[model samples]
Target: MPDIVSKSRSGTLGPAPAARTPRRHTVAVLAFPGISPFHLSVPSLVFGRIGAGGAEASPYRVVICAERPGTLSTPAGFDIVVPAGLEALDGADTVVVPSWERDMPLPEPVRAALRRAHADGARIVGLCLGAWAIAASGLADGREVTTHWSAAAELARAHPAVRVRADTLWSDDGDVITSAGVAAALDCCLHLVRKDHGSRAATELARRLVLAPHRSGSQAQYIPVAVPEALDNDPLEQAMVWARTHLDDPLDLDTWARTALMSRRTFTRRFRDRTGSSPQQWLLHQRVDHARLLLESTDDTMDRIAADTGLGTAVNLRHHFHRLLGTSPAAHRMLFRHPAA
Candidate 1:
């Protein structure tokens, strides 16, 4: 079926008074039979916060629910008791399906519940193979989503209407968000915190959990190892290493090809085949990525960052950074900068 789904509606809220109680957003995590303990804990670990005084300090309330509301066995040779049934999703601000079993048929009740949640304006998240659950519900039919790279082909084959982006670590389509795999699930959930609360809040939370503050969703999810051994002589790998070191210098197709000891045409073909992008495109992305790191971790000026990254001027840096990452350099630093103090 060529699946087209309905859009979710959103409401605006007014500002609260200083002394007002914190508004708690309810998060519902769904568990099913044979679910992984790690996948099931991702959401809870991300959202639940404990205060220094041992009180619940988070602005989110997380709950676990199952279709049958009973003990479910895990592949890790343990069991978890779920106290709430599908009814737990009723008042949830967000509904998360951590992961779904491979090739398992979607239950009709679960599908209907998901559809109802979406219709009621709740955000839906599918971590890893959980995207299969969302796809089966018809909510993600025409949406661009992602899942584990190994299962991406199967997801595309099963739900041809959903655009499966296997390259990205995650995909956020407004109300519907999906992630690539296990660790990517943490990245996606942390991304959700950043989206809802703000970068500073997400950064503090990530520090508490000892996780990377932010990994851009656009980063490649599954890059193959460039070399099997340190001593292995690979021209392409050598060229890439040289390029990384020489990013502050002006580089072009000819220079890169020469570095690899190959002609321009051959270099272009091999580069595209190996990296899935043209040399020019790859170089630009690398420069911008370096710029991002400089912005986040250093006190460099725009001009300095641009010069250091081989981007020439501040104007050129802003133009390319905004074009690629949808934000200005200054703003990125403001959101992500961590002072050494």
Candidate 2:
């Protein structure tokens, strides 16, 4: 028989098939000089918040380690005392380097410690500007990485060997994981949690945090587009209001355009200009939103929920639900189903 190996949710290596030991993972987050308070807090919060609501199967032990035992100054002008030194990483299963100062080079000792941790089978994570530090250590020479969009071009210019992808929220090249700017660090950490635990655990954590569980790497970082909120005290808003009230009915673009008192072509263009999406897209979003609320608050069947949301069929609902929420209606209901309370 072929050997069966366990795998982490992120598809990383876990344990040998024959190993009977329980998995207890240790995560060591590096708190070097000039680290961002936000970056440091993100990992601490995510890991600490684990096991809060009955999730205790394989908990994480998160420790903050510094280059030396001393007080570190944060960019926010706050001082944090970190007593654990590089030796704190001794038995860590994963090592994380959060955001660091942009222009400063990582100390040689820290570089050596990082390399040693990786060689000892620890996964290395670089968040935001911390990706630069990982690249400085020379381990990410040929790896694909993403940093803050503003810094992506600079990193590429400095290190031609590293394939820099600025748009992605994060990317994992086996042992090394790199994430984009500040808030994306949260997503990256959640990604790690999902990888180590499972989708259910990660989704619960995200619900507590009130964040989307999984946004694809291809999703664009939203840039604020300056546009008028409402072009007129127009009938479009009225039609939208009507659609919300009548989601159970089939609502096509023609119906909405007719209600808006505009030609199909004009309504389509103006709707996109006003809402950044076409009429059909907006209606679909509204329907999905209603379906999600129904899924969470009712014991309605998939077919009934689909009809109630105007998605027409359970199959269509499942398709759009997976595409938008990264999970199916049934799974979502299992996680969030509740009666009106």
Candidate 3:
């Protein structure tokens, strides 16, 4: 197994799996003046049901609310009518503050409501510039938080209390979670679903939404350059494809470098440029991802899974799985295994 340390700072393991009579979790997304429509829609799209029958089948009940119940303008050149007020957050299990005007002063009423919700044990999420509101409300003071990189310096200068990381896609400090901009919001929300449900459900939901099943929050929020259009013809891509299929084989950096027709030094630099991770780190993740699929779909023993995924032994598999995913293989299977299996 790889010796990589887990970057997940999120301490809370989501609410325990549903009981015999499960209650739907309530997610309250805050809407404010000049909010982004796409930002406002992320949580709803991730946690809310689509049709009338959708709510009945889904495990979460999502509601949109603002400081006052009325029409609010968005930067998208339109207005959205919010149906609820701060009271909507009173019974919420989670409160999501999406990207908002970072310079705008946090409203006293809104700040108080957020404090009350957090006092009642609600998980508070600040997506992008929403971290400004969280910080201003004193919720994120002394906590490690993150936001869109462009505004990170400003956030730090203004708050002067919270530790800000501009590189991370998201930071989950148990009750308070913050994420980088735009697409990172989607990743954060899906992570909430995965924490609440399990990998299988989150994976299926990602498929339905046409989103990547998972992107570790530790991943760099943005890649500085675009992948070349001719990437398909690159030997690096071919090498990656080959490695995915030959995971069961004992592979090393020398073999991978040779397969890519490059020296180890050149391969290392290019691989990071292309994938934003060291070769070993990327390969470790791939092996763990494959192990997840096996755990979710099959009844194979730990040793069998370990050998098949090239982790070498059952002990190695358990150590790496728990370090990366925060759960044991058996526990994961119990949460995600096919019922028939």
TM-score of 3: 0.80
Extract clashing residue pairs from model 1.
none
Taken over the whole model, the C-alpha lDDT of each candidate is 0.85, 0.80, 0.85
Best candidate (score: TM-score): 3
Model 3, position 80: C-alpha lDDT score = 94
Q: Per-residue alpha-carbon lDDT of model 3 for 176-269, expressed as tens digits?
A: 9999988899888887777677766777778888898777534441657467678778898999999999888899999999999999999999
lDDT of 2 by residue, 184-262 (tens): 8889999888766666677788998888876543223243445556746767677778788988987777877888898
Task: List where candidate 1 sits over 4 angstroms from the true fold.
Answer: 1-18, 49-55, 216-226, 231-248, 253-279, 291-341
The alpha-carbon lDDT assigned to residue 213 of candidate 3 equals: 74
111, model 3: CA deviation in Å? 2.3
TM-score of 1: 0.75
Q: Please state the error at residue 98 of candidate 3 in Å.
A: 1.7
